[model samples]
Target: MAQQNGMVEKRGAGHWLTHAGLILGVLFIFFPIWLAFVASTVTQPEIARPPMPLLPGGHLWQNYSKALTSGINAPVALMLFNSAVMAIGIAVGKIAISLLSAFAIVYFRFPGRHLFFWLIFLTLMLPVEVRIVPTYEVAANFGMLNSYGGLILPLVASATATFLFRQFFMTVPDELAEAARVDGAQPMRFFVDILLPMSRTNIAALFVILFIYGWNQYLWPLLITTDPSMNTIVMGIKQMFPSGDDLADWPVIMATSILAMIPPVLVVIGMQKLFIRGLVESEK
Candidate 1:
């Protein structure tokens, strides 16, 4: 009895230590953003000046006004709209395509079906960076540049999500499918009635993941678009880092960065339940 109590005490101590480490790590990750938030309310010079201000300044409204309506070149409102249109469009396109692809792989077996599956799995090995040039040419060839379609086409499918659903589909009971077919139900009917309902947790989880991925897409967007008006908030932030000894307006830049971060943070927070449930369900 004493030995068991000692073991439990050891585990309790270990768990507390692990949790403490996690809390410290989270704080470290968020500190930079907190500093940026503080800096956003200061003069551009003061924002960039040495002996960095530990506390926020009084120029918040002043900076907010300018940052929101930056200038003739890069208005915050327009860039935010583009980011929204691109992010939502890509998320929807990606989810729809991934769902259909996953469904086809799970339900219908055609020639080279395994080959197609393996090819998608292979893409897991090669990230977007590897085939960037080819992807760029393909997009340019389609004349999709500077359009919402350009922003969305290349990212319309997600291998990770498809694989997630495929693995989940495998675990679904064959009995249910057989019963549905006996009841004169079609594949589409079974999918709509049984598969999709059970997969909601995983789907919601993937939605959050895909949304974040789309929201942070910068490289392809930058390469495909030369129009400043079409530039994402990230690209606008990049543009603020002027080359050749020019000083960056840190306050406005930091303010702009903070503004861009709000939506994704809200998304993750909003989807917390679905994310956790998906992770748990996938384990089963």
Candidate 2:
């Protein structure tokens, strides 16, 4: 009894320490965001002055409204819309293509199947940065510049997602495929009815990750979109900064930064449960 009680006491102490550490970590990460929110709500003088205020101010509506309607290059609302379209397009396109490619690789017995999978896998080494010059030329030839296709298409073929889906499909019992075949279901029907339902958590996980990836893209959008109307929120935020000796608009800039975070935050929060399950859960 004494030994077991000692073990319990040690575990209890460790548990408390873990909780305390987690709380501190949360505070550390959240403090900057809190400061940004406060800065967004206050006047420029408050932020520029020493020892910035910790509390939010009354200018929240004024700052955010100005940011939404009249940003430095383009309106925040328009940039947000452009970012949403790009993010959704990238996530959905990557998932769809990966699902089809992974499905064929796993379910079919075509010649060079392994070779094809390996080819796709090897492209992981050749990310967009590596091929940016040729990619830009191709997009230019296709007249995709300043378009959503240019923003999304060149970035959507995710080797990691393909590999993940292939691995998941492999784990699916062969018996299910056989059962569906015995029931006279076509390949498309089986995919739609059986595999898609099983892959919901995984799709949710990838959607959250890919959406953030797309939303945070800067270089690609900067390269492709010269028109201010096509600018994404990430680009808009950077553009909001003064180029020369001009005084920066701290409140509006901070407000734009806050607005930039909302969509990705909402996506992660909405899909938190499924994202966790997809990353950790093993069973189909």
lDDT of each: 0.80, 0.89
Q: What is the lDDT of residue 123 in candidate 2?
A: 87
Best candidate, TM-score:
2
**Residue range 1-284, candidate 1, lDDT tens digits:** 56666654557769799889999999999899889998888776775568778798898887767877873258877788888888888877876777788889988888989999988878777777889999988999999888888988887756777788888888999999889989999989988889899988677777776777788888978887789888888667887677879778788788889888998889878888875665554444
lDDT of 2 by residue, 117-230 (tens): 889979889978788888999999999999999999999987888988999999999999999999999999999999999998789888778888889998889889989999
Candidate 1 stretches with Cα past 4 Å from truth are 1-27, 276-284
| Candidate 2 ranges beyond 4 A from true positions | 1-21, 277-284
| Model 2 / residue 180 / CA error / Å | 2.3
Worst 10 residues of 1 by lDDT: 275-284
Tell me the lDDT of model 2 at 222.
Answer: 85
- Ten contiguous residues with the weakest lDDT in model 2: 275-284
Best candidate (score: lDDT): 2
